[model samples]
Target: MAMRVVDAAAAAIAALLGFVLALPFCLAAPSITTHGSDGGGGSYVSAVGDPGMRRDGLHVAWEAWNFCNEVGREAPGMGSPRGADCFDLENGVDENGQPTYKVVHRVTDADNNLRAGDPLPGSPANITDVDLYAAAKELYLGDRCQVPDSPSPWQFWMVMLKNGNLDTTAAICPENGRPARPFSQTSRFPCPGGAGCMNQPLVFHNRTALDATGRRLRGGLFGTYDLDAADLGSKEVSYYSVTWEKDLGSGGWVFHHKLRTAPKYPWLMLYLRSDATKGFSGGYHYDTRGMTKMVPESPNFKVRVTLEVKQGGGPNSQFYLMDMGSCWKNDGRPCDGDTATDVTRYSEMIINPETPSWCTRRRIEECPPWHTFRNGTRVHRTDAARFPYAAYHVYCSPGNARAAEQPTTYCDAYSNPQPQEILQLVPHPVWGEFGYPTAKGQGWIGDPRTWELDVGALSQALYFYQDPGTPPAKRKWSSLDVGTEIYVSKYAEAEWTLSGFDIVVPEDCVGSSQGGPLVPEFLILCDETLILEIPNQRVPISRGEEEQGKVTHTHEGCLEEVAAGEHLVGGRELAEIPDPAPDLGDAVAAGAQHDEHGGGDRLDHDGAAPALGAVDGEQREASERRAEEQHEHQRRLRGQQREEQLDHGCGGESVDPSNRWWARRRRRKWGRRDVGSGGISRRAIWGDGIRSSRSESSRRIHNGRLLEAVLGASSF
Candidate 1:
């Protein structure tokens, strides 16, 4: 038997904050079975008006890390483990009203090659050292790539390159936050041959400028670590490159990433991440610059992304669809500067359906203690009949977990600057509830897609250790990314393109049943995908997962439910919840037309303004009137939606664990129905389904503190 989890700890806080948790009446609403007007409904939040790759100009960079995340032996004269090529496009209006944009390159080679021992033009000599040198290098690059916008400032997207081989004999990385100690190792820690095998690479940057075609703005950075070896086989040596381009002033940026492994650097990894703007990102020990300024917490956010794989690195390339990294103490406290106690936590959805699950009914060590249901029930990992073993790739706990339940797998000690916990999932029926790819090869090489995932809700249900009496750690994620770690696979090369990516924390007030107060979310106020936010200010970060994460595919997995409701109120026959607005559209389908003047008032279409007040003349008055009117309108709509419920043959107020889960598990024997504006429909956040090895597929509900509002059970 598994330990039962009722609602998440965050629910209690949400309720006390004055948010109304509305329960349905005894009578159910009419069954929702209407096909959306666009002919097909889009993701509830994503349908808001997907910006869909609009040109924000090309901004790109690349960085490499050693075992301790430091630039060890900076690749001979390759300078620091940092370099960038960022540019913006300025559109010029032609006399005929045609638009022409020019690429503006801001960073120079002099900026990238500056070493720590050299004099920084504007700085004093005090902050000179290896660590400070890298820090200063980033700051200087930020100066060149910085793009100003309302709300907060931001920088270019980062292309991260990491070499996993660690020479433990060298004592380069710390152990469990303590100083690095001499530890005897074998094949576990990958080493090619020599002692200095752990070194940065020779990085080259092609500053952003118009490509020869002259029609598109393009730039890229490519490099290799086989410093002195020129006769390297495509797979015998290591190489990586990321070239970005966009039609001047037109589509969104397209970042094409290519990573290859060699005999020496077989465990190389690469990812595009949205990190914190001014705080620590995943696996990072210092304050950094990034795309996501505002970090996102679990169960309350959704991610929209598009991925197309050009080449699948060999079987060992563990690609991630969405890898979210965060930090906190084992005691459930916000992580501060203490590298020793602070743990780097990650939850990755691996898409390589071929990846085997290290977890199984007999392998409890590879799984979390219990799985939460959509109806808020819990299934212990021991529930052989119920637990979905294949969904999990692996589960590793933090090294610092004091009382980690007996059956647990501790994470790798050398892979991070601090102890870390990882939860890896793969694409399976168990995740179908979250709108993820259900079968293998659904979105691999030839099948590209735009995915809307309920990351917030699913993460809430996943288990993270907390001290006995400590308030559960607020799962405030700092990094959300998509990339690959080609674990020691020689000659493995993976190529993919990602664009139109976003993570949204709906604008709903903390808890109240209020609406229309939040500004529709955008790709970035900082003009980059990585966002580092100052808690509630919505600022994007550089290490950027908290607010912005990359969208990727593993060579692995996925991320969630609800509906037209009916009820019999006062015993009167109801058709549907009269005008009851679905608590959907948590910032999906955002676009350039969403009112840059105030960052409020989105305009998906002409009709969207009726639901969201306009930002034109008489804006204040119109907004006030609209607010009051909407309140009254929703009151009636709720009644109608309620009455409609009575007409539908579904109603049972006491809550049914099987029929619907609290956060996920909504089903329809019929087809789909429209839920939000702009062809949006009700979609699940994070959900799971269980299919016994080629057996019957049964949907298991996972309910956690993922969503801030009530989407009800019956979700994925």
Candidate 2:
């Protein structure tokens, strides 16, 4: 009887949610047209600086990594395995009255060839460790590619390369961010010939220059994982390359990528990422730089891309047509570099036809508990007849999650420096509502199409875990990418081209209005004038006009009832704002409660209930301990500096090794699990009927930012 009641309530909420979202779907239907404006004025603006990669000037970079995301040792002569091709184009008329472009490359071979132990320009000559040198090199390249803009400066498109060979005997990778002890290798995790298996790749770069026509710009980066191989063109070695080109004044740049794997290095990954320009990007512990200037939050952004997959990497290839990544703690606070408590949340759509779904009716743990359809109707994984098992590839719970569903497989603990959660989906009819491929091979090899996906609507509907009674985490995605993970397979190769990549968000939803109500009114703000016109009032408000009035109106298309206190901005109706709160809380509550139940019922590797409680309490203690350590280190450093100055008279202050040790220690502490923030609760704007005083919003954000700054400074 209780189960029946829960089902009935869920059905009712789904219906209500469907009614609220129907009209919005109609208003912003997906279109292939590049321009959103009709020559008249419009509100839409591209969130990316180089939207569609159409700009004449190109900014692109590449970074290579060993098994643990660190550069354990530099390639023989290839520097730190970080290189870039950023250039500007100067246009002029030729003698034949045709257009001509002269390319100006910013990064030179000298900059790219600075090996690990080499001195960097404009910096003290003491920083020489391979991993630290690579981090510094990326920053150097970013400076050469930065484009200063309104909100924030932006960097180049990042081409990331990674190898999945782990030398377990090395004990290099931390165990879920803790100090790891060496162990014997397991078959599931590969380590072919153990020693030197985790070496960095050899790199090659083709600087961007004028094409034969002198009207096009082109460049590329290619290399191999087989460090000892003499010939890159030989067929027996693992290899990868990305060649990008753009017409002088035409459409987006096309990035063609090809990756091949050999028997020794069978598992590899390559991705073109639009990472955040500042702050920590997905899966990265340090501060970073990249293309996305304004991060896109969930349920309010759209992603567009043009992909053509010529070859799939055999059956093991997981080709992500679209992959989104974000970071947040289990208890709904943003990540502040605490690896133990911070979880990397990722969602990917594997378009490879060979990838089969591991999520089935009988394997509920491999699936998110429920699937929410377009019309708000949700079916649990146990509903064999109604659940679309074919739509999911697999769902892996976080390794540190104590409350994960039974039989759930934890993600690979060694891949990332921190615990991670992943949800991989495949093509199916159920995804059609979000403009995704509805069937297998819909956008594969021969069926390439320019996709304008309604990512926000779809992501909002998906199920991600959180503890019960905790405020929901704001899904502010920091990395939007497209690429492939060719799982262990010998002699397998994949080729693809990606273009017209972009992420778009509603103007009002970003920045200041992050926590504001979702107003349905057509808010036209021109020349300092803010016009809020209801749907009934189609009359256009002229620019530079100020007016304040109230009017009653009704839209028969919208059927959801507005709860009390949810008043329109101005009058009878502000333009029936899509139900400010779509009643989808029943689903969230049910999902979250299930997580708590799992925590109590499940056992950790050490046979105990994991430390899932006292989130804020423990985090506060961690923060204070971090602060005390910082003061102690600073005081000791000051005394040492004074002693050096007095003893040596005029010696330059040297960089401290203690500082680096402090960073590693902090990373280890973060690996120890500090879940939530210090009692910071701002009414999370979810469909649930939860509310909080507006007074706490500013204080909470301020403290979050302050703590983030403190943690960052303390580490560096």
Candidate 3:
């Protein structure tokens, strides 16, 4: 009887949620169109905002690592797989006739050639051993990409390379910062041969210079891992190259990347990253330098850029359309330089249309317990038919999730600096609500596009599990980037071009709105205009059937679905309608006590609970209940405001409707739709409800199950 009642209350709440979202379905799903935004947010994002043109004057460097994200051994003469070519072009006419200007390359050959033991020109006292060599190399590149004039100085983008080979017999890499014990191969780690297998790449760079096009300039950095192989003239053996080019008189610079794998060096990875300006980046355990002078926090920012992948590198290549990086303590506190406790969290949209999803019924560990919809609804992975399987490549838990759900799969530990968590989304309808590509190859080779993604909104809807009682950690992202990590596979190659990278935050939700650990170097202006006070107010308008106190429309010749009826949210669902404490646990309360039941005993009604059955004539019933609740919520809100006004009546000030409207308009401007059954709007949750049942059914989406049923769509 108790189980039945819980199911019924859930059904009631669900039915209420359905009535609110019906209109959005009739209007059609919201299109991915650009909304105007004033730059009023706490974000040190990318410099270029234009999506079509590739911007130049960029500070891009390179770093190569062994299997453990470390430099195992400098390949022959290659000091380290870390180097960069950064320059600024000056446009002007020569003395006689032809248009000419001196394009200067800041980094010298000596800087790039310095080997492991060689002392730097002016090495700092603190950097003694290998740290000094790494620091000097970084400073060398920093000098090249350094952009002047601003109070806060900046550096170049980092091009990271890694070889997935661990010399286990050698036991070179330490275990958690301590020395490692020698071990034999167990068919797991890919340490092919003996000593030389983990060698770094031999690097070469061709500095940028104005080409014969007179209007065009080009430069490149190339390298190979087969130290003794004579393949520099040709790429017969393992090879990689990044050639950046741009028309001096035209658009932004375009970076063209080409990578090939050889037998000796089968697994390889290359990525273009926008790291922090000066702080530890995603996987780095050091004080790093990068592009995000200001880090963007959860549910507040968006990333804009263009990617054109020419060739999908075989099967193992994990091509990320957009990869977000963040670091936080397991206890939900900010990262205070603790390697053991600081965890790196990553969310990646893998765009390999051919990539198979590893998150299947048998591979429950690779899947989060539940998948969140764009709306605040959740769908358990056990609901196989409802979970969007094809929409995800795989999901690996943070190595540290102590109480992770049963039968879980932890992330590959040998890569990141510390324990890591990866949520790899795929190119499926599930992501269409965030302006992401709905179909495979939508933004690949033949197609290039300007994407405006609501990264903040979508991120808020993702599943990041923590211990039941732990406070929700602020999803503060440290790195935002795009590139491909081509796993070790011989006789294979990958290529692509990237440009117009940007990170954007809503104009209104800046300053205190997006909270995170305080870093003095990031915020300078400390603008208060970005701070937003979201007053919880529900708008009451009749939208689904009139006498039923609801409003909606129907399309002709559509597939039949559960009929709409009135059945509104009651019981604990109405408790604290908006922005409850983040500490709230997602686990369902086991049962209800006496007086907590909403009126009477209820039934599961069908295979699924009826209250959760938001569709059918039940909604007509819910509409009646919701109408009364909306009025009550509004009345109570107004009364509270009135009391506050009376307390300050001596000041002769009053809150007007215009002011309320203005605040509401600002919320919409910032794309904060607030979708929830209790306080947010139906339109907000059913952002994808407009699609005809057929289209919606074809792709998976995150809008809660109610949206799926209301739109007559299916999942999994």
Candidate 4:
């Protein structure tokens, strides 16, 4: 009798609210075309699955690491250090014509709570070892959260937490990728409590759900490295939290991050990363999965993000505005899961004003061998007056570089699975051309701003070592992130919010199995003024003016004409592209130009110049297309081979390709959509809700607000 009444009451409430449950689906399931070339002739495509992070349904995950970028041991009851939160939003109309929504989650608490000894669903067998289990679990979670898309399926954004305590006496980490024996405790590596100091954190998740307002989604992961602490709010306890929230109908998701350090865990690092969907990423030797649908290569990609630093972590905080990581051999080959041969390379821009530059003339070993200016000029560290010493914080060479210059500081040997190289930068006039901060405190704290960093150009200009006779390695970055590393600072706190994050690369550069251009034609609404804000410029389009025949826009002193019905957005015009730098041979000669300044002998191991140079236009284009085709073919073959080898159930049982799981993966691997002659309509470009009849005043107001939200008030 009581059950009947309760069921009747629930039905009544459901009917009153007009609540309708929709079938579970991923965000933007019916793929709309997203790749295009602007009218100004710059062709580009999003490198990430969720461009600008504007999708209402979100996909994100979390992972924790010890000092050496691995799961040392799991905390008390906290499973294998990997977890995910992925969900889709369902919309419905209420009885009063008001809107209603529901969050349909893809992953559950049971999946997240699986411990090291537990079996992974699609693994070859149950893994009992903690480190190997964590790596396998990450792959399992990635499968659960994977989103089907063109080119390939992608996983989630990674929120990575790392405890920097190192127990040298335990000898768990390798030295320069070689096995290390136990040693006495040293003050150099922080291990406040000795033996178990490198344990993983206690992670707690708040599954995403409709907030009290019913119009917003909210969720978070919060916990402490100091697992014994009873209260997270206490100053002595290390705590970290990353919470996400977004309104239902519009705007991008904002990730709120807070990290605090305690005495015992003084060196802690937290970052939000866009890692490669497959293969090794950054310092990890295991196969990793993440949001970067296409790994971005140096000299061809740009990173756009909106960051607001609310509280500076402190003087000891190494706040990286942008951090890029990749792995390659010193001999110019790609890494193939060999820890002994692979080397991780990292470049970061530290925005903390209090951080001092350590690459001064007095500390010559801390500086890179050479610095390249935006105008293609080169200067060696020995050319003290010409070299911008203040631009660099510190540069450490890889431990295994056979021909590394004398008086160089090798990077910390035990902090990564393999040898590593690091280039740390500080704000100075030298970096202004890359859209980086021109001075200290530009984007720190109260000066929060949206940064459109030309990471490709900057990285191309930066110096990275290669073997003397080898071809330069392709700088394909597998991980790009932003965060703070509170280095040996106790009771310190850092707070920030990140949004509108995106990685963009040239459309033609991205591989297409079909061997055809991936450009999409875009249509503009009849008389609407479309305003597009790209990296360094704003294009205001008034269709009425365009119909007068040709639309002309000036970019970098060059005039580009756009025909009617065509539009431009999201990329730089061709004329804005600077000439490619000289070949590595020429760069070596240029470096030698300053030989009289006592840097002559350092050029011996600089290697062949980077693969950057200009050639006759038509020939260069054709050659590049052919090279890309060959590379894509090889890449596909490798991918298929890997897939076949790893396709098995938990008990090492092979699963048929006809199974639903395999079918989904196969269906998602189709190439990009062929370009259509008719072009994409305005509705396709901006989605359906925008009204064509909105008043000019109203549209102007809306555009202003959007610019302010994305670029901050300074954009005006």
Candidate 5:
């Protein structure tokens, strides 16, 4: 009798130990599910630090550019044209116990006022060039507003203002990334004033401040490219402003933008951009910084935003509903900042109703060589009847492309710092699948709506040029923006408001390949209960087996519920298991299924499975059998407990064996009723097998050893 009792105890311990070890692996697995308006199955996460612009504390910056996207010279007393408004909100209770909040600023006015010849923190000494100073100032300001996150840290959103007046006579702008000589100016190049036409704007800052109610925070940066203008309100002078406001703890920050063009600065561009946190952003050669923490790749990301255009700038206003920017060589390799060799690639959807498509049958050069449909069908520009010309505004090839097909319109050589290719789209039925505007006036002036754009799918289908016979470049977008560029128009005004902006990409696209943790540690104790342990919070995940052939778990206030029929366990999907006795082998098979679904099996830094494959085939089989026995034991234990409850009518105290076992262990280990510090302890049984205490020489003992020990003890 004594031997039998000891054997039963040993079996119980082994069963619980196996469950504890398997929980983390199951939860850490990647699952597939549709996200946003893009109907696709994949694990998604926000690519930005402040997803949807919902954070009360805001981080935003501003930059001014010349014709070729560089600052030729700073406006007098306007610093480097790089500025930031970043702050944190402190929540506290007053003496009356009423909530009190204080706004704490990060980047000060002094920081924003630093200019050329002024020493900047973290910048190279003796750097006095106007363009280099602006670039360094942007990096300096980004460091001030940086937010720490997994995978990498992120900075602020960018408000980009550009003066499009290129002084061809002065040779200020480069021609296809090469030095240019003086040439006679013409109507093709808009420079109403001769020299110094591509000068920076005079920037004015209205530092963010709280209102009397203390529940609202507002701030803005406004200026004009007309440096000599005495009055900003004057209609003859160009003006631009981007103001942000948000109600504390409710809704997203609304960015209100206004841009006006004048005769001197007839062609002006203003945009709210989300640039990469590191590396060169589109149209830029220097290392840049902005809100995009995880730069989204093509075919696996989506953009969500709410836009209201109060007034369109003019008929010449090229209003971009969405503009994506990336850089690569014609040979399909990533750009290495070699301006002469690198080519900037841009694709944008122009929502202006009056904007006509230049891609007519007669203008084959304005159209791409080929158009790809959502269904993978291809139609050449020559196929007039089948090609959707109305869907495209124009397609321009890079100037330096050696193998561009015949009848191609090379983009303006002086517009960007490098040779560039541009694909401009218009409202058409072909783009309806991506949730873009399908008609001329769908989201124009009077139509204000929230847009969830399938930018990924559309970008993948769009035509971009590459040298023939070269491998395709990975189309990873480094810059995303929305706004309008008033093309050589005088006294034109554009007003708009943007909110709820976000870029979402598959969670696996983030840190999986980088060997960073996909998510916080989670442990699903039993098949029925899941306890997710994030830093400083414990969220319960309830299992729902209501629908047949489907298993769902809803995480309260933590994450979106798994889609129907998707057996997601700990952020990963599991293969369907038999009802009566689900074997541990199914979990192992699920790991393989995850690799087939989308993202490959989770890997450690050195690209190896930490614990899943550690158990040999024979050991895995034994573990599966022991897991089945444990399931049977739990079922019997629950049945006996229910019977006792019915017989004695016991209400208060629980009789579940697992509960009693945990309770006894809790008291013995810590002399307390609760778990240690509300988080998993180092000594606790977790993923990657049991992690030993810090003092132990061996950091981890594999699950194979654990199974061997459990089986050996059970044999007694």
Candidate 6:
């Protein structure tokens, strides 16, 4: 007889960390249901504002950058290179009792068009430095899209674009965050004739709008690094565009992204990131806003994603199927943004079949000291027979380590605000145990499948550097994303679509039986459809049923209620997660609105402010009328009530085995509901398989030290 698991070791760990454990169907009704993780009679409560991307209202933002991730200069007429598309969906029954809806946009074109050094309309003054201005603008947009929730409010999914050409002579980027001396050009990095090569891109946005039938919502952002080009239609220029669309009530939003590389601009990066709602994320130094309100720690959280890659950028493209990032100090403590002391850590699974492993038998330095197996066995790099060298593409140590291991490759010193450590992986059989791609071309073009990755389990087994004899650092990840980094791929284009992305964490972090915070809750997600099917043979039958040639009828399967925290000895494997998009190009010749020298004509600033006097009365009248028309249109778009039934996207579906087993005991029903903002129960599980607790704060106490104390001293 198959033992129906209501209590599993993994599920209990996930429950304490806010993972949704499915209970059996409790009623005889044709309906869907959502369950809360707080141990109350189950009710659905989404951990994110737009659960499963199934909401008509959308919140998404975009940011562009130069070689060192800073706004060295702004493009002409385009403000700080940051923009957002945030809106609400209004629904009502028409005269015929059919649903009618409208898109209400919150951010205006004028607001998104503000350039650096320009004063914000009707707002207090802020720092005018180019880099500082862009950061502030991000915060401003976050305020507009912020959705209040239990742990904290959330903003939007970040679409990040970056150009990777550095003008060595400019010395704009520091070495490990410390000022660097100007150096001559080297073949390792590229530059197109020095001057104006580091300028930002010309960005364009299409506000989210309804289709003719008002049954679909669509919008996009498109532009290029070649500022002088007429538009994306112009030839010989690098370009990028991301379009988002959704059918009314069909499922989840679908993001389609396209990136083209140019000869001059050969290396670029683009990614859709789910960052911490209010804290420093991965490589960034400033506090950022994003979809994850509760960050997930390693060994407790998992991710679910669906990705389809259309065009790989030749052999040089390092397309990340799943990329995760976090920050910490050398002493095994969380990072507090001290550039000199903090180190950014990254792990990426590169799925390109052409990408080869740099860690070979002769290149011990390129490999981590040890390889860990799922069963808790560790093999040294010297143990080539046991060590899975092909499992790793390369491992780079942080540049700031004092006592370094010999022959190790240090990460690029100038790519981020601080020193960094990076681990890149290629597809191999070793990863199969974690639900990752077992071979090449598994999820590449023409072969798309939804993945439910055991990210927590895999990350726990991966090797990371730490100071000798120091306590192990808490593996709390602040940023998780997917996409591609086309390293110097001249004239290549990469395209793809990403949907059904999410991270799942536990509901609470009360002390666990194992003496750590991790507790698992069984979550089984069937691809495409939400229905979870367990075969009857997998369930146990009563003794009397054997004599009658049939089991005591429950439905089709047997129901078993085991004690919580027991191991799920026999069950099918769960699925994994996914990432999105491709790379930016080389820093091609770009246009900077302002003159490089002090004596040239100023593009925007004038000697005197225009007077509000009677001069040019007719012109002033025309301007006023135009402004009034624009205002009227905006008012009409936003005039409706804010609340309505949520139109859910089709993704982020997970089921807990034990929880669903209990659900089967009675008649419970679930209908569509708004993805509202509110405080979560202490036991609120994220949908993506990552573990998180609403009651837990970011300032976690570790080994007699406080993470908050470190945060307080940092620039954030």
The estimated TM-scores of all candidates read: 0.66, 0.68, 0.65, 0.69, 0.68, 0.66
Residues 1-716, candidate 3: write the lDDT tens digits. Answer: 32222233333223333332222110000111111222232333333222233545445678887776666556676664567777666767777877776677777777777766776666644333553467556766675667642213567777877787777788766543345677886445666656778878877888887787676778888878777777554545778888888877678878898888776777787787877666567777666666654455545467878778888788878888888887766555556666566777789888877778888877777887667665434566777889887777788777676666667788765566567778888888988988787888888767877787777556656766554433245555667788877766766788988877777653322222123211111100000010001111111111111122221110010111221222211111122111101111211122311110101122221121112112236754675566565665544544444222111100011111111121232233223443111112323333422122333422221212121222222211
Which of the predicted structures, 1 or 4, would earn the higher TM-score when compared with the native? 4
Tens digits of per-residue lDDT, candidate 4, 477-547, equal 88999999999988899999999999987653443434332221111111122322122122332222001
Residues 441-552 of candidate 5 have per-residue lDDT tens digits of 9888999989988787677667777664332455678899999988988889999999999998755333232333334233322211223332112222221211112112
Query: What are the per-residue Cα lDDT tens digits for candidate 1 across 1-716?
Result: 01011122123222221221222111111111111112343223211112344645555566788876777666777777777777666778879997766766787778788776877667777445676678777777877777664223556566788888889788888887778787765787887856888888778777777766667766778888778767545556688888877776466778799988888888888898766555678888777766653455544466788899877788877889889888888765667879889998888888865578889988899987666553345566888999888788898878887767667889887778788888888888867766667777777888888887767656666666654433245556667778888887877889999988776653331211122232212111111111111112121111111111111100000000011123222222223221111111321222323221101123332221111111334754554465455554434544554222211111111111111111111222112232111111234333221111212122221121122222123221
How do the residues 444-511 of candidate 2 rate in per-residue lDDT, one tens digit apiece? Answer: 98988899886766765676666543334656677889999998787889999999998876543322
Clashing residue pair totals per candidate (backbone < 3 A): 129, 3, 41, 1, 3, 84
CA lDDT, every model vs. true structure: 0.55, 0.61, 0.53, 0.66, 0.67, 0.60
Candidate 4 TM-score over all chains jointly: 0.69
Error of 4 at 395 (Å): 0.5
Residue pairs with backbone atoms closer than 3 Å in model 2 (clashes): 340-670, 340-671, 403-599
Task: Please write out the lDDT profile of model 6 over residues 465-502, one tens digit for every residue.
Answer: 65542323556677888888999877778898988878
